[model samples]
Target: MVFVESELGLHSELESVNAVKILIAGGFGVGKTTLVTTISEIAPLRTEEQLSALSASVDDLTGVESKTTTTVALDFGRITLSSELVLYLFGTPGQDRFWFMWKELSVGALGAVVLIDTRRLEECFSAVDYFESRHIPFIIGVNCFDGADVYDEDEIRAALDLSEQVEIRYCDVRDRESAKQILISLMEYLVAGANSGV
Candidate 1:
């Protein structure tokens, strides 16, 4: 929890606020940037560059061939979840070459939202492994792309090799309400774990 100096003089009435760090991580073209932009209160900062022809061989574009730009570094955004809490979101670049930045971005993060595209579930394997090995709590947000086949939560969990404790939810990252729910779900999970001493 964190306390801030308020001009309204409402500190005495309201409790201290919490500022949490959260990571939005997933594979390339998985809508990490879209999710951040959708829910941020302020204009989000994005470090994206036009896809270069020279790097075509290095970056795979099987499903997302229409993508013109790729995040080179990271995306930063913030949202006030409530009067008592605010969330800082950091979206990691999805390319393998930029994975070195994940270690830095992930530091001090409360938890993560692993966005997934059903068309390329295999692309998220590294992210899932990274979070699991570090013991960081995370929930899977399956971005339902148009025409993409939908899978039940249990099936996705088995495919991702996740334990029963990890939660999986369907989401449409482009919708602000849906994006907000993902963050709320993560916070709820974190609070539950803290209460359970897990």
Candidate 2:
């Protein structure tokens, strides 16, 4: 448990604990907000706005193209897995135009989850590239959209040119259990990597 000495005799855990920051990053309408809300202990914070005419030219309108609201800034939420394991989840804005915020969003992050839309797999390239460039450990989750072609893990790995070491899998963002599984997979991957000093 996290503990801190306080003059104000009312002691509270987390008074001196450092939380691990984890980034949930992806392209437009990739279910980042849903995943954060599903697992966070607190209500997730999001900067969402209705789609304007100008957004059509920019945001992808293919699969979730009908999605009216989009997250503009970052989404923040907290989840405490154990007495000493608090996690701060930061959901990044997905539009490629907001690329400038990525570096700042990534600062001091333990790792990231790169969500991908199967219909627009190429859109995830930038997110993958960014993490790889910075050498931040991350897992790629293919957000399975209705009517989209289903690809096996091997096919996805080959198609994304993912190195053998990178973790890749499929997920359905709307399902809370599915989302939780994805996060658990990422946590395991990160813990294993840390133990191996990777």
Candidate 3:
């Protein structure tokens, strides 16, 4: 529990906390839903639908051949980062057809994490641009995948056109601990930005 010192110099537990909204965005098949499910305290709310043959013309599945389903709207989850802070995660649908929902989902968001799939690097450019255009503070999380080509931090940073100040962490969204750490890093970055008034 988080405690605050009252004017009387007595310590009291905090009962109320404002929940921050965070968007998990990325290109198609970048594991945004998986990341939310791995770290969410409650069962995640998924808006997924099976991919049919008609989807081939609209959705690009260049690197993610095995992906059978796609997030049609959004994936919702909740996580308690600290006793004083709770986060509401909204995972945006990755397809361009659903790009309309990104703006709606991003309303009042504190920041975002653009999950990256190294194999489909170009696919994430739209997500990165959306957050950048809105002036929202965000970080890149390299969602490491098995059998994917390895890319260094410098390479990713350059490829994404991110400044040196933007933090990047390697993680596998399927692993709860690894994904949680990336969230922790994002919270830390947000705190530091708040402290520095960035």
Best by lDDT: 1
* Residue-level lDDT tens digits of model 1 in 55-165: 788889999999999999999998876666778899999989999999999999999999999999988999999999999999999999988999999889989999998
Q: Weakest 10 consecutive residues, lDDT, candidate 2? A: 1-10
Colliding pairs, model 3: none
- Put down candidate 2 lDDT per residue, 48-134, tens digits, no spaces: 899999988877688775699988888888766555567789999889777788889999999999998878888788889999999
The RMSD of every model to the true structure, in order and in angstroms, is 3.7, 4.1, 4.9
Evaluate all candidate structures by whole-model CA lDDT and list the values in order.
0.90, 0.83, 0.88
Better of 2 and 3 by TM-score: 3
For candidate 3, the per-residue lDDT at 52 reads 95
Model 2 misplacement above 4 A: 1-12, 15-18
lDDT of 3 by residue, 74-185 (tens): 9999887666677889999998999999889998999999999999899889998998899898999999999999999999999999888789999999998888888888
Extract clashing residue pairs from model 1.
Answer: none
Clashes of each: 0, 0, 0
- Model 1, total clashes: 0
List runs of model 3 lying over 4 Å from the truth.
1-15
